[model samples]
Target: MDAKEKPETTSSMPQRRPDCIKCFDALWFCYSPFHQMQNYYRYGEFDNCFGKWGDLVDCLALKTKRAAEAEEILIAREKAKPHIWTFRTVDEASENWWRMYKHLVLMSPPLPGAAQPPPRSDKS
Candidate 1:
């Protein structure tokens, strides 16, 4: 055998995943439709993949060692978001926008400390 014909070995091959990305990819795959459907057909429900989720969480927490703190912070941030912050259809979103800022809409009081504009004319 010649040098050009040398066989490749595991040590010389590139790794499928060399970082935390592997854990993330595995977690995503666990949540994919194909995997979930297969699991559902066999087990009547999706695979929880809690171990994969834990692996990714652990991998990320390795950097700051603050997994619990991070989860709390995320939950707090979610709770602090405005009602309009969530995604909705155009009609649904545009409707009832006033509910989010009812305080700002002084319909009854009608323009405090400011003069009312001139009324519209039919001419134009």
Candidate 2:
């Protein structure tokens, strides 16, 4: 707290890159017919966020300007992108579903410390 001394500070947050695609998507949402229709119904006129279009344009330009670094990140993301795993056959999917159903419906026990669930009241 001395006049000539600097305050001690510490920060350990990870840096995150701003995503250009989010800006592009926001711009598209602003221009969608469904949104315009909703605006018309609510206010008796259509409205659009043209400023979001400028955000998208600026993002694209920045990406182009930093192509060298951006390209490296893009390459890493392309290589790391995950495809969902799937059951190859209908029978395989059905078998897995039945196994899960049986486990939950018949085999699993209540947690040791938990009270039994109340019986569900019929609504008719």
Candidate 3:
């Protein structure tokens, strides 16, 4: 077979992912019709290849390891602009944000210079 007559093959191509900066999470992307159609050519039913909790965890681990190797703590936060979408109502959107704020407050570690909680008293 002549080289010029051979059909084009993608064997030498690298894997690709959609640059979804607006994506929230894996489930959201996986269920999104837009993403489904976008990735239809590469991966039809495997949306997790781009976005997943495990992928985030792995990224954190790698970053942490690299920071430790460099003798630096990975303590940083980026203020992100929230994505706006139509909710049931303005009240519903406010409530959703309030709930997320509460969750963060409960789960986050004490901030620097914040009062430490009282030590737990154990009864023998």
- Give per-model TM-scores: 0.35, 0.36, 0.23
What is candidate 1's lDDT per residue for 19-99, written digit by digit as tens? 588899999999999999999999999899999988888667654646456556556665798978578886456444644
Which tens-of-lDDT digit does each residue in 1-124 have in candidate 3? 8877988766675333323333336646666777777778676553555446555554555444543342322222112434475346765665556556766655788798964433344733
Candidate 1 vs candidate 2: which has greater TM-score?
Answer: 2
- Candidate 2 lDDT over residue span 45-101, tens digit each: 877687897888766765665555765665677579776774358756655566567
> Which one wins on lDDT?
1
lDDT score at residue 103, model 2, on the 0-100 scale: 54
Give the top-scoring candidate (TM-score).
Answer: 2
- Output the better candidate (1/3) by lDDT: 1
Q: Rank candidates, TM-score, best first.
A: 2, 1, 3
Output the better candidate (2/3) by TM-score: 2
Query: Which stretches of candidate 1 lie above 4 Å from their native place?
Result: 1-18, 65-124
Give model 2's TM-score versus the native structure.
0.36
